[model samples]
Target: MAIDLEIWWLRCLSFIIVIPFLGPHLVAIWKMLKDLLFFMVIIAIVMIGYGVASRSMVYYPTVNNFTTEAGGSIDNSFDGRSVFRQIIYPVYYFLYGDFSDELANLDSNPDAGWSIADHVLLAVHMLFVNILLFNLLIAMFTKRYEKVHQETRTIWHSQQYLFTREYFTRSPFLPPISLIYDIYCLIRMFVFFIRRNYFETPVYQHTRVFKIIPKKRDTIKEWHNFEDAYTYEYAHDEVKALKTASMKSKSGSDSDNKDDTTTDDNDLNNTTNGLKQVQRSLTRLERIVEELNVQLEGAIEKKQNPTTP
Candidate 1:
């Protein structure tokens, strides 16, 4: 089959132009569909299983037998041999909070009434379908919706960038001009690719703002050397300051010690002065005692030699 290049080209152009506007909404829809697909798979499997179980165990024997006995063929209309009618519809009804009429009929009729197994099966089905699966699907959809809604701006901007890039690369909307422009672009790209280094280098080196910035070419060893140099300088200054402080402290302590020694010498001189004063007082008292003894001796001499009186 011959392909319509024009149709495809127009579609591509339209997609590029329109998608930027509706990107977020379209993305949200897509995400919702994806989440719902998984949710649906789980629900379908569980529902189908219950449906098959109920049909085989409960319906086939009771409803089918009843229809057969009521002047009907073996393949009765009420038999519900189709999976859609039997399993899907029943599960759908159960999930949507409409208790099945067939179940109600079976419950009312004592002959075709639910047995213990049937009751248990219905209870379990209701628990999963009505209580669990339904709520889970709602929660999953709500979470996905909120996520898509929250990230709408980011998604839209990213998609806009892509669209704008495509639009610029492509030709104008006019057929003749667009074709000419496309051909030109194609030739330009081919030439650019062939001589990539020649064309690309100038654009990259001169036109690009990012390329103007200097890139660091330091190796691990160089980085380590820089760190070591910084650390050594810092440590050297710190050690110099510490040594100066230590020397100052030593000089101050030596001066304090000299002052202490001077104070001790003064205290010793005062003690020596006090001792000399006590010695002088003792010497004067001894002289007085000696003088009194001399006077008594003279009196005794006078008594013995009394002829002059």
Candidate 2:
């Protein structure tokens, strides 16, 4: 709740810099998702190389009901080898193509609860290698990703809407503290988006970003001022229609009462003046009540927290 305004401004400025172009952020996320699949693929490739080098490469071994070919029975054991092959590829990349797939061939039958912690420093080994493998993959993707990022940045930087529009008016009148909190949170999200903008294609850039041009806003008066367009007769027609509906609702024999009950000019004027007075009185009363409530709460608190109560 104790928001620092300085931090808020910093965040706002950062968001302007980071998310001004969303193409990069989108691309980064896409690349990350794409890389997830390749993470396994690259690992498998390395594992195969390791198996070949170590002379431990066996037939693309099937287990767990899997045949060497697809569309075969699900040998529970063959399923196990499929899992091994899965693990083997990534492991090869991590081991610098040094370790064999022998570990994957540890047992024809899986341990009741399978894990590799028994004989090898599995966690440490996996952590170090996965870091390098993932780093290399991300680096490669990011390089390609940044090319698209520059184009987005250039496009957005040239776009005048970023500055022309009041970027801070989403709430119109939220307190400085609240805006600060919002800016801080949004800056991080925008940073994430900035990373995405890098990977989007040119087609994506034109189609999505082009439509974001600011639409002209109609002023309140422009919308609410129907006096010129709607004549006094047009307005009076509504009142007459209501009366006619009321007459229909009553017995047809009593329809004469509807014309007699038609509102006169004096009655309409008085009603309008009375409504205005009531609105003014209500506004004044609301302020007074609010002030009284605050004072009452303060007095109660003072009594509760007196020095020698």
Candidate 3:
């Protein structure tokens, strides 16, 4: 009994192990299956119609050839007793390039009651199933894959959140012991329900308002961080642009040294001073932005979670 229990537990664990790996991809797989279901409906209609028609064409021809014992060899691939083997399987297999035998039978016994209609039907069936329907299915799959690829990161994060919440909320105990935890929860819920309905002031009637406030604060902090980073990048780009302009001015001044060397030297000094001033202004602006960010964060913290006294 212990061995049996162990085997069962192991199997359960194996299944559980696959959840994390398959969780993110489950949505994409579901979408693909939905598309495939629609495609299958169309395929079913076409296959059944063609199968019945093809089978009817060959049904009398094969029967007569069999009884008369004609010199031509019989094609039994689509001459089975059951509808499945005679029609459905033959047509389905034909989609996968199994047409040589059927074609050969037609060629070898041209006078065996086979006509242009049979050949035309076979051509039409292959054109629809192999070329049209199959390609359409492939295109549908590709479109679904592209959509899933675009949202892969979002899907992964959502799946991770669900996994995290599941593990955090679930009982820590395994299997048999977890059943005990479940019963404990059931009783707690029943008691809580009774208290809430019967008592004026239920002990478990605490609001979840406090829990949500912290999440709001965290979101605000993230936005503030993003703003600060953007400000810094903009300042950095401005500084780079000023430096490039200064370099170009200095190069131009150097190139014009033939006409008034003294003037070129003075112009270079002016450009250098202008660049230094721009850098200082940028540094001061960055300092102000940082100070403002700190003050804003402090104000938000005070507003969200004010000190009791």
Highest TM-score, which number? 3
List runs of model 3 lying over 4 Å from the truth. Answer: 1-29, 61-81, 112-115, 199-201, 205-220, 223-309
Among all windows of ten consecutive residues in candidate 2, which has the lowest summed lDDT?
A: 206-215
Model 1, range 103-132, lDDT digits (tens) per residue? 665566555444456777888988877888
Question: Number of the top candidate by lDDT?
Answer: 3
Model 3 residue 288 CA deviation (Å) reads 31
lDDT of 3 by residue, 205-307 (tens): 4532312223465786676678768866876787677667666766777656566566666666776787687668767877887786678678777887888
Error of 3 at 203 (Å): 3.6
Write down the TM-score of every candidate: 0.43, 0.24, 0.51
Ranking by lDDT: 3, 1, 2
- Which is better, 1 or 3, measured by lDDT? 3
Where does candidate 1 clash, by residue pair?
none
- TM-score, ranked from best to worst: 3, 1, 2
Prediction 2 TM-score vs. true: 0.24
lDDT per residue as tens, model 2, 202-291 = 322222122231122233233323432454345456556555655454444344454544544334555566556655655675576567
Estimate candidate 3's alpha-carbon lDDT, on a 0 to 1 scale: 0.71
